[model samples]
Target: MDNQTKQTVSQIPLLTTKAGPRDGDKWIERMKEEYTSLIKYVEINKKSDNDWFNIESNQMGTRWQGKCWYIYNFKKYEFDFEFDMPITYPETAPEIAIPELENKTEKMYRGGKICLTVHFKPLWARNVPHFGIAHALALGLAPWLAAEVPHLVENNMIKDK
Candidate 1:
């Protein structure tokens, strides 16, 4: 990458984790359940319908990094995001972020982790075992996009589709 094209990212605050012991076996069990439900929800909501959104997850270690699309005003916009799990597993919700939109908003961390400072995190904490990628997408990213994307489009910060 050329120096002229190099990106400059501003630091954004991350979610501070609550103190807890790390359990590998528990993490394994939670990940399995989460991924299963995530796939099922995506298949049912995205694949089975003619909706304005779709997602396909490709696992990479503890993260679910994949393609996601949203149709706005009859145009499709495709982007990539990752759901990176912290060591705390179910004790803390995975950091779901759109790397492509980095530095565009204060709502996201410099590393592209979306800041779930609102009800999203609290809700997930309340239903740790049940909350998964699907819940994060539905309750977190989807709503964030619905709100922020429009502002981004208006300012030409991002393309609307």
Candidate 2:
């Protein structure tokens, strides 16, 4: 990771509890931690003029949807994204997707699930309960956008709006 990304990851607080939806009350506690960390991440992004996404979870806190954007060559490229927390969330990072980008790039899976770097899963494995949605966005999506958006634009896989 780059210095700026490291700094951004450091800014978002790590989640404390290791609870998933099946844990009942403990899951509630985990949710609180997730929201707090997300709020902090969003604020940091906003303050840095680097805000790139807006996300909200379902009532169960297991499904999330949002819009994410990349500004490349002074053009804004936006896409709607969503993901569902696996029953083993915190143990398994949710696979975030931009459905509209499906088949547009080789970096994505069949359903538009962004293919994380080979380094990502191992990193998440090491962090475990400490990593949350905020970390995923910072480490996963942000870098993917930085690397792929330029290629996508250059190749005409995506267009600026």
**Error in Å for residue 99 of model 2:** 0.5
Q: What TM-score number comes out for model 1?
A: 0.73
| Candidate 2 lDDT (Cα, 0 to 1) | 0.92
Query: Candidate 1, residues 1-161: lDDT per residue as tens digits?
Result: 22311111011112222322255555455555655666565555644363434455444336567766666676566778886567776667778878989998888897887778786888778875555566677667767777777667667888744
Off by over 4 Å in 1: 1-26, 47-61
lDDT of 2 at 130: 98
Candidate 2: which stretches are off by over 4 Å?
none
Tell me the deviation in Å of residue 107 in model 1: 1.9
Write out the backbone clash pairs for model 2.
Answer: none
Q: Cα deviation in Å at residue 75, candidate 1? A: 1.6
lDDT of 2 by residue, 83-141 (tens): 99889988999899989989988889979999985868889999999999999999998
Give the best candidate by lDDT.
2
Q: How many clashes in each structure? A: 1, 0
Over all chains combined, what TM-score does candidate 2 have? 0.97
